[model samples]
Target: MRVYDVEGFPNPARVRIALAEKGAVDDVQFVSVDVMNGEHRSAEYVSKNPDASVPLLELDDGTYLSQCTAITEYIDGTYSGASLCGQSPKERAIIHMMNRRAENGLLDAVGDYFHHATPGLGPTLETNQVADWGKLRKSKAIETMRYLDDTLKSRTYVAGDTFSMADITVFAGLAFADFAKIEIPAELTHLSAWRKKVAARPSINA
Candidate 1:
């Protein structure tokens, strides 16, 4: 399988962490896509991913998969290792719920703030920016940080006790926040501690 992604991007980081956690990082080939140069918008690349997003997975049989959650699902289901999604139906549902929450509430919000409020990649790719909307989303991201901090105060991980995809999603989100220069509020001590712990993971270091 060939995974088309850019290094240091949050979504691709999520996929890499998933692959590492599943022990399948060495099983797939990594292809770097120069998204900053508008390579993703090119007709050839758009033919594979209509959304023009990175972290696209192409199977050996020529099937293409986009979206981080879907790609992680394929990896977790196909790869033989410890499960990242969860083992039981309840755990799976909760993990999915928290994963989406982290994605929408934090990661996507931080991305919106970066692209709309601030000059994201560059003027070429970040066309039609709305500073006011981006500012609002930035506030939303900070608010979500508080929510997550509170959530983490009671549990060791995002969904429950185990280290699941929800933790990975939030970790990637915070990494994106850091790249965008969005500082985590000083009052979010739990979130800060959690960030430090997650950052030490070998998957994240990879």
Candidate 2:
């Protein structure tokens, strides 16, 4: 399999961590995408992924998969490791629910704020930005942080006990928030504590 992404970018980091957790990091070939140079927008790149997003997975037989959720699901299913999705129906529903919340409320919110409100990736890539929309999303991101902090006060991980894809999403979200200069409030001790534990994980630490 070939995974196309830019290292250290928030979304790409999610896939790398997932791959590491599955012990499949070395199994896949990584192709770098130069977003800053507009390589992702090139016709050659868009042919494989219309979304023009990074962290894309290409199966050996010529299948292309984009989006972190879909790519992570493929990795979790194909590789032998603790399930990142879930085993039972209930677990699946809960994990997926939490994952969506983390993506929309935190990750994407921070991304919107960065790209729209701030000078994200500079004027070349961040054209057509809406400051008001970005500001609104920034507020939503902060609200989600508070919610996650409260949620973590009880559970050990984002989606209950085991560290699942939801946890990866939230971890990447917080990392992006930091890069975007959106502060996670100091009062959110539970979130901070949870982040510390996740950071120490072998997958993330790698």
Candidate 3:
């Protein structure tokens, strides 16, 4: 298998962390996508992934997969490790629910604010700037932080007792928030603490 991505990007980071968690990072080939140069948006790249997004997975059987969630799910299922996606029906549902919340609320929200309101990827890529909508999404991202803080007060991880893909999503979301200059409130102690704990994980620390 091969993974195409740009290092340090939030979405790519999620898939990389998932591979690390499964101890499968060494087993796969990682191809760097020149996102800064807009290589990901090129016509040839778009053919394989219509979304033209980084962190694309090309399976050995000649199947191409895009989207961080879908790529991570494939990696989780293919490798023998503690599952990132859940093992049971109910667990999968809960993990997916929380993962979506984290992705939509924090990660994607921060991304919208960065690309729309700010000079994200410079003028070359961020052609459609909507300051007002981006500002609104920035507020949404912060609101999600507070919600996550409250939720984390009771649960050890985002979805439940064990660390799952939902936890990875939240961690990357918070990292993206930092990069986008969206401050996670100091008053959200639970969130801050949980972030610190997650940061220390082998998958992240590595």
Using lDDT as the measure, the top candidate is: 2
lDDT of each: 0.93, 0.96, 0.92
**Candidate 2 structure lDDT:** 0.96
Q: TM-score of predicted model 3?
A: 0.98
Q: For candidate 1, give the lDDT of residue 196.
A: 92
Residue-wise C-alpha lDDT for candidate 2, range 71-177, written one tens digit per residue: 99999999997999999999999999999999999999999999999999999899999999999999999999999999999999999999999999999999999
Can you write out model 1's per-residue Cα lDDT over 78-163, one digit (the tens) per residue?
98877889999999999999999999989999999999988788888999999999899889899999999999999999998889
Between candidates 1 and 3, the one scoring higher on TM-score is 3
Per-residue lDDT of candidate 3, residues 1-206 (tens digit): 89999888899899989999999989889899998899998999999999989889998998999998898898899899899999999999999999999999999999999999999889988887999989999999999999999999999999999999999999999899899999999899999999999999999955
Q: List the residue pairs that clash in candidate 2.
A: none
Candidates, ranked, lDDT: 2, 1, 3
TM-score of 1: 0.97
TM-score of each: 0.97, 0.99, 0.98
Model 2: runs farther than 4 Å from truth? none
Predictions: Cα RMSD each:
0.9, 0.6, 0.8
